[model samples]
Target: MKPRLLLTLATVLGFSAGTVQADTIGDPVRGEQLFKRDCAACHQLGEGAVNRVGPQLNGVFDRRAGSLASFSYSKGMSRMGADGLTWTLETLDAYLANPRSLVSGTRMSYRGMKEQQDRSALMAYLRTWSDKPQNIPEASPTARPTVPELDPKILAIQGDPAYGEYLSSECTTCHQRDGSDQGIPAITRWPQDDFVAAMHAYKQKLRPHPVMQMMASRLTDEEIASLAAYFAALD
Candidate 1:
């Protein structure tokens, strides 16, 4: 094949692969169910949809935050738009998980959907309503332009397991140390980094577990790192 033709073929294949990956990650049917259950009260979609508690969501993807002329927006959302924030699948997932955390001082109050599968489904369903749905590949081998920002405080902390062990007693009451699978998950044997990330997610209200969000809210970054270290070290 000629070099230009080969290049064209490669581009076409790559685009086809990305589209397939995006379509498969979330089931639109399930996503619609979750939307009605969790988000229908506040938002709407399609032509002639009206904004309620939240803005109408038609043409949401790739649009700047607070860009819509028809609805009232929160100060933080307007600031984000001023800072050049646009909605994409990755951004949408983060916002869906925790609206206030993604954009500090957002007016939206709902805690977030914890089930990743549900979020994926909701995202797929939402794509159909958008004027332009961005199709980001699932776990793309290529680097993404957008990365979720991490809290500097948490990133700076060097964890101490000894200190963490002392702090972990409170966590054990609910999360449980025993290996048995029950209502709550077993908390021990986590990797240090994953544990830290999960704790920070809770603290930042990204995880949407009400009690954990409240509990993590009071913890300092050092404390979270320490607790992560302690839990991670145990069997």
Candidate 2:
């Protein structure tokens, strides 16, 4: 494809793209597997669920962040609840991606889930417990998973690594070149499409990180692709 055409396509996709939504819940069985692998140790759900290390997630959807009267929550989580952080599909996805990013002093130590599919499945599983028509009130349609899938054409862009290297100085300030994560998550060696999609999310303010949003807001589609290329090739 011509360079001009590629740029045009990127611009068109970058601005107009939105998350994919489905009318029905994702696979709860798969979600249950993920939960068992990652969350079950700390939390309990479904019938006979009770507070474990983490609060029981029976009615998690639409609930305040730390509003369970029986649970002792971190001050930061409680503050987030007081500040009106409700658990909806959007907010839940953000929190699952990176808990610390949303609630700085939260006690949940698990690193966030990176795969959008996995998060959506988990959200679906959680939603099943929260929104049973036979038991609870009808759930809002907006509570469905809002997972975004990048356009294949946009992902096909081949960025200039040299330009990416030049632009990467800003990124290296927070993301270490050596791939070691201190407080922030590691960005090195991520898949090119994942990097691009994440930057776009930050640019759109969907990821909810102020610094990332500010940084991504200044990046063009090509610049983002360049950065993704550069980072993916990094050690």
Going through the candidates in the order shown, the clash numbers are 0, 0
- Candidate RMSDs in Å, in order, are 19.6, 15.8
Candidate 2 lDDT, 102-162, residue by residue in tens: 9989999999999988988898888888865555545534344334344556556688878
TM-scores of all predicted structures: 0.48, 0.51
lDDT of 1 by residue, 94-192 (tens): 999988889998988889998888988888777777653236433222212322333564457688889888888888788787645589887788888
lDDT of 1 at 133: 26
* Candidate 1 stretches greater than 4 Å from native: 1-23, 132-235
Work out candidate 2's RMSD over C-alphas: 15.8
Worst-scoring 10-residue span by lDDT in model 2:
140-149
List where candidate 2 sits over 4 angstroms from the true fold.
Answer: 1-25, 133-138, 142-235
What lDDT would candidate 1 get against the real structure? 0.78
Clash count, candidate 2: 0
